[model samples]
Target chain A: MVFSRYNSSHSTAPSAPELPPESYHQPQQQQYQSYYGQPSSIYGQSGGFPAGTQPDVVRAFQMVDRDRSGFIDEHELQQALSSGYQRFNLRTIRLLMFLFKNPYDSLRIGPAEFASLWSCLGHWRAIFERFDRDRSGKIDSMELRDALYSLGYAVPPSVFQVLISKYDNGTGKAGLDFDSFVECGMIVKGLTDKFKEKDKEYRGSATLSYDSFLCMVIPFLVSYD
Target chain B: MVFSRYNSSHSTAPSAPELPPESYHQPQQQQYQSYYGQPSSIYGQSGGFPAGTQPDVVRAFQMVDRDRSGFIDEHELQQALSSGYQRFNLRTIRLLMFLFKNPYDSLRIGPAEFASLWSCLGHWRAIFERFDRDRSGKIDSMELRDALYSLGYAVPPSVFQVLISKYDNGTGKAGLDFDSFVECGMIVKGLTDKFKEKDKEYRGSATLSYDSFLCMVIPFLVSYD
Candidate 1:
């Protein structure tokens, strides 16, 4: 909760991007429709984005690569998303970079990586729509909780408050846009899956030595190679 | 799963201790009976052992401290449990030491720490009994799964296999005695509770910035401080 409070306060300035939600359209919705029904395909067998979305992903990448350098650095990414009126906290950006599989350890996004990220975004959009029950273009705390339960996590109310406060814009309301919802879902899914591995026996519990617990959770907490 | 394979194979030698179940009796069953019915009081306001269980905890500590050294070192603990025919893997021992709140850097269990652990064991026994639906002294995989689910975890089958294999004695059956059951339950509860703090919205999920995720989970994982 403290973490969310810090994040919301730091990013809630009026300078927050005011992009229209429509700007985040799926680049090639019609082409990807067949695959949409099977939402799981987006995250291939290895849980990475599929290769089929490459062409449209390339086009979207070019749109963001304003300088045509064939690669988008962090600054360019921030600027491009802002130009489109979609502002995100630094943590979200960093996580996206990690999820995109930045190559060369250079902290830059190239065509291949961008395509992967683009495909993920499309999947996230589909997921967001499913959970946005009110269709208000944003998901409130209750919706977020339901979505996560659907994903197999049963979070406690106290912890849920911290989560909402972290993403809630300064309006004192707990609402998350498509991007925030996806990011939050990804984190919960990742950690839940990891924890479940130890709770083998589906017993909803697992005994771990302190060392083993550290070994399993550290990677989820920090991305340092 | 791999971890379990490693642990089981490494510990499967005929030399493994075979402690008897009765060795781990509730330290102060009569004195703590009033609290036992309540269950919550075992974990007093400070989250330590209730004062009522202290005398019995001291008695149990002395039983384990066979050498009259005023402390139970790791070897003595392993020997004591094994003599009782309940052998635990090294990881479990390390975790127990951590949970017992060893005062010195050295890995030893004194009366104060033993009292705290004894209190926790009583609570664990109650929980184990609640889940041991068959009234058997041991909990099988299915029973373990049900118990964990009750504790708010939805473990997958694959992960369950790993857990069973890790604690299952070589009798070709999956079973966990009171000690193993308690150890596993504690870790799951610890980690699950930590995750819930982040999922404060009761949304069944939460978004954790990598750093924030790390900050919350590390304390549960290790006791280096």
Candidate 2:
């Protein structure tokens, strides 16, 4: 019912790719292939969704692109996500935009880009729910630590301080809600991915020159702005 | 045979506390009580060794205090630990001293303090071995992450960089051997424990005024020197 509210009969929108009626029954691996081949290096690793999730992503994009413009900006993304998940604040939405920036247009993500972003968000949402074990709608530092551990990132407690200082919901509380958790997970994952790019041997150390290091890291730092 | 090398027929040393010959047969919990009530708050939380471990700690201390002075300095600690565990470097020994400083003497730890410190190291050693899954005698960044995670610290990948830069054994390679790993663990554990004291609600955060916060934190930063 929540999704139907955003449907404007734009199911016939041609800018969005057409889904074959029989595509759902095809081999599951082939359907997820469409979600890949995007320009998102930060998310490239987590590309490809579980089988049968493609249409739902496309439908979500269609619902948010209520004007049938074939594209949706941060506001539309927020509305689309709120309908499907919960409301995500503007700052987190902006950070998501910075991370999943649409290659064709900086201001909006099209069908393919939206699918990629949604898949990534779904991945993070699962992680967020798993670590929010207290069901408190947020995760404390210990939970955050465990969540990051499961992702193969062992951050120090000091990093917890930095994360809370940056991503806490400004409500004078200590934990992170879903939106902020996603934002935090993305930044850490992004930075680690960036680092791992240089650490190809996976020895956990890299030898990048000063300029090269700055160029690699500066974008993630300033992306939300 | 390795321990016999350090034995100097000083088991009768009078300065160290006398161990009742039959203490070993007592209930397991009672044997561990002597390891607690130390002045080292950082290690107090980890006080008490496993059952029947007290005699081993005392024997290790006696072996190192060859002069029968009832106290061991950094050199003696290095010798003592090397006898039981892998040889710990002087720097790590000094870090241990800083963390488990003797109440009556800054430069040395007597039998009681030594027991507390040993039990804490045993705790960390078990953690270190568990995460060093490859049994490589050292842990790369990923393993370090798991180690810290087990200890309730989820540091950022960036902190791993800091730790590697600081504790990477000066070998031009990344990864920390036992000594450096222990040093890293203690500093992180110490800082986290301090923070948790003020974060009484376990919310992963605490609010402190400028001076109080600095006083709480600066010591951990400068303690090595």
Candidate 3:
């Protein structure tokens, strides 16, 4: 209920520049905020990290810079942030930087390493190949609603109506596509879906056995719950 | 951190009550609220809850009545708002009266039930009994500080400075007593401790083991490491 009090002032239009920051969104200001979300302008000016960086740092920087771009742009950065390259708090980023500050040793995280970190943490979502099962480049309203239902929010039709009214702003239409939807999840949807998709993949069958769901979700929940 | 932003605003001294709605000292609010933090507020004029209502709704209503005051004051209302009861939503309060809808049954919450709900999710301070080791009315700084240090973020001294400055206005000092200290741990300390605490309580140990310490403290490093 207090959460709603804080959210009441959120964007009137879901497509508006930004939604309100919940307690979870507090991570944005960290300097290591590289490779996450569509950089909201204040990012990317770290000025090519200095030399003498650790190998992983050097490598992470290089790999993250796809297309041979001297610097990673918004897209690459966002994927990295969404991926497990940065899951914990800013301190972990600090620790990583402390360990690999040398530009030469910079760790340019690849998808596999990223997945490994999350996997160890029991986060299966880190392993999602890519979302947009329909290849729509973004998830739709019903798609997300179903996913949340699977997560146990009891999101009935009325809740959906409120959810859409709260989040939808597609040129007078109600409902979210990828960008808006991603924003609603505060870029964490990528993290969440990583597990959901992985859970599906691990079960090998379409449906999940309760044991497998517990297996996949429990550790992350236990650690962070 | 974004937390600084929220704290800067939320922790500011409750502004001088200028407008009527926000204009009252807490004690004044408490005296009026004691009787009303319950289901009976709906029957304020009649003075009793009608029998026969759904259990959850009845429970929600009772929880809101925090004090047994015959009438719930706005301040009493806010306390319930911050706590677990969902009924404190501003709109819900307005609608219940205007629509002549009494959806809940009994509105009395016994302390035991309230205690369980508070344990599940609580703010940084004021958990009862569990950590208030000496049963002193307030939390002490050392106990609370030690608890947070184990979790990670070295609690910025400034946060305590402000909290004490406000909460201990009369005492001219603010520090966590044990209860407040443990409350912070229960929230930020993570789930590793849940099992550790469970085992400790289950085994009935006065002294803690390193395994419990690892479970309680080291796992938290995953967040900060």
Q: DockQ for model 1?
A: 0.02
RMSD of 3: 18.3
Highest-DockQ candidate: 3
RMSD of each: 17.8, 20.4, 18.3
Question: Could you give candidate 3's per-residue lDDT for residues B1-225 as a string of tens digits?
Answer: 322211122223221111111222233334335545464544344223323433443354456665453334333443653544333433222221211211121122222223333333233333334445777745555555543443332344554433333234235545553333332333332332233233333331123222222223222222100
Candidate 2 residue-wise lDDT at A196: 51
Candidate 1 regions with alpha-carbon error over 4 angstroms: A1-51, A62-73, A76-85, A100-113, A133-135, A150-162, A165-173, A196-202, A207-225, B1-225
Sorting all predicted structures by DockQ, with the top scorer first, yields: 3, 1, 2
Instruction: Place model 2 in a CAPRI quality band.
Output: incorrect
- Tell me the TM-score of each prediction against the true structure: 0.34, 0.37, 0.25
Screening candidate 2 with a backbone cut-off below 3 angstroms (N, C-alpha, C), the clashing residue pairs are A155-B154, A155-B155, A155-B156, A156-B155, A156-B156
Error of 2 at B124 (Å): 50
By TM-score, the better pick of 1 and 3 is: 1
